[model samples]
Target: MKYVNEAYDFVNHAWSKGKIKKLIAPLEGLAYCTTVKGFKEVGLGVQPEESNYFNFFYPKGRFHDSLYGDDFPAEDLVSDCICEAVKQYIEGANSEFQVPFVRILIDLMSNPRFTYLRDGETEKKYVHVIPDDDNAYLLALRGEFLAKFHFGNKSDADDEYRAEFTSEEIDEMRKMSDLAIDWSKVNYESA
Candidate 1:
């Protein structure tokens, strides 16, 4: 349970700082130790003097000692468990939401005549806003983007999808898109 708590804290710290890359080494090490050959390679081989009361007749080997020894930090054990959980969460979010949302945004951005329909009806559609519309266009785009992305489904359900992305990530996406649009506008005007 102590190891589990430590693992939870480690994951939270890494996630908060957007340092998901830090989990890679532990994940790789866990992967490497899954096979018998890998276990033998990584494991601290046979120890002769180590004997538990239950196994007094038969002393523990190097592999057993390596696992139970004080030298093996609790961090390593919990890291493997936490890293697997994080990996699964990322995969699920990517497949279920992120990829689809990005694809929909890209498709919409490429089409000049694209309109976001609040309902499936023409009367409820939101067409591209004019330059004089102030923030109306951005609001429309956000609504349409969220609608098309089906983000409402997850947003209504305790916002589990929001945990998959950091605020910086969302901001970066907006910044990049704005920069690209500004560049395009300047080039179009010059030409």
Candidate 2:
């Protein structure tokens, strides 16, 4: 498909520019959001008018219709193309980097908090916070989570969603969350 070719071109150009490292976080985030949170589609676009950086878009619902009009590819098609593109990139990555990248992906996949969003919402009612007893605590926690991770800002939050985990577990979740940011831009020629 044309979208598949375009995705491959985008990834290959990133590889050539020595900027693929910047894509690691965004790609993993896309994968996590789709496979884990049930997002319909995710895309990488270079916004020259804005930051000139590649941004990942996983629109909540009909948002894509307004953004891309009727010409946008099917959701499943785009998802498959993204998966294929990521696979090809990982396969072609340097061995040293590949090992650590795979490790990070594995850790991320194993962490339930990495896929905290439900039905495209990360707010109070949508997020699955445990021990739903303390309303004030839940509101504060949700606010912190959204502010730090959702609003493109970074800040610490108490893990009151459940019984607190060990230090190591918390560290792993923090690392993955930190890596979940906007994709970095790349130079690619569309064929």
Candidate 3:
């Protein structure tokens, strides 16, 4: 929800056919935090060849691996933690919940619930949009018309809605995120 306002700004310009620039400053911070959190959650360097069972991407720039099949650490692959957070949030739930970080924030900000709630509504639905950054956007309903956007980055930048994981996996991700957020806060305070 922190990026909700910015998301709305981007959406306005996107719909109005205005120039939408990447908000790199906020993204960098979020990415760093997200990377740190993910590292803590799974313990990086612990497994260079382990099966991640999770997929991650670099939101800032493009990087490539020399080997085709070797599994690289997800953190090393991406710089945008917010992007990753978006991914984890909707990784496995309803196929309708997949999307990019930007659009989701915009929808949540534009709508009232301040989360993803379409004002005075009751029921869940999926909203999809293709962001300027070449990422697909999808949102899942939370409350009455209240939906949450989770990020999913692909090579072609295809803006398609698909169920990435099962409902149980989505729930597990939610629980993991709760811990990650608290971990981030504690570390921030200590710093």
lDDT by residue (tens digit), candidate 2, 110-173? 4432222345332212111222223211111222113122221123253332222233433443
Best by lDDT: 2
> What C-alpha lDDT does candidate 2 achieve relative to the native structure?
0.33
Give the range where candidate 1 is weakest over 10 consecutive residues by summed lDDT. 53-62
Pick by lDDT: 1 or 2, better one: 2
lDDT of each: 0.30, 0.33, 0.32
Runs with alpha carbons beyond 4 Å of true place in candidate 1: 1-5, 10-17, 25-33, 38-47, 50-63, 66-191
C-alpha displacement of 108 in model 3, angstroms? 16
lDDT of 2 at 2: 29
> Candidate 3 on 1-191: residue-level lDDT in tens?
34423334324336332222243345444323332221112111122222222222222222223123233433333332343434343442246766564665444324331122232232222222333433443323222222344544454244333223233434554465432322222111100
RMSD of each: 26.5, 18.3, 21.7
Q: After superposition, how far is residue 157 of candidate 2 from its true place, in Å?
A: 48
lDDT of 1 by residue, 70-105 (tens): 224323433444544544445555364454323432
Q: Which stretches of candidate 2 lie over 4 Å from their true place?
A: 1-67, 70-78, 81-85, 99-191
TM per candidate comes to 0.19, 0.20, 0.20
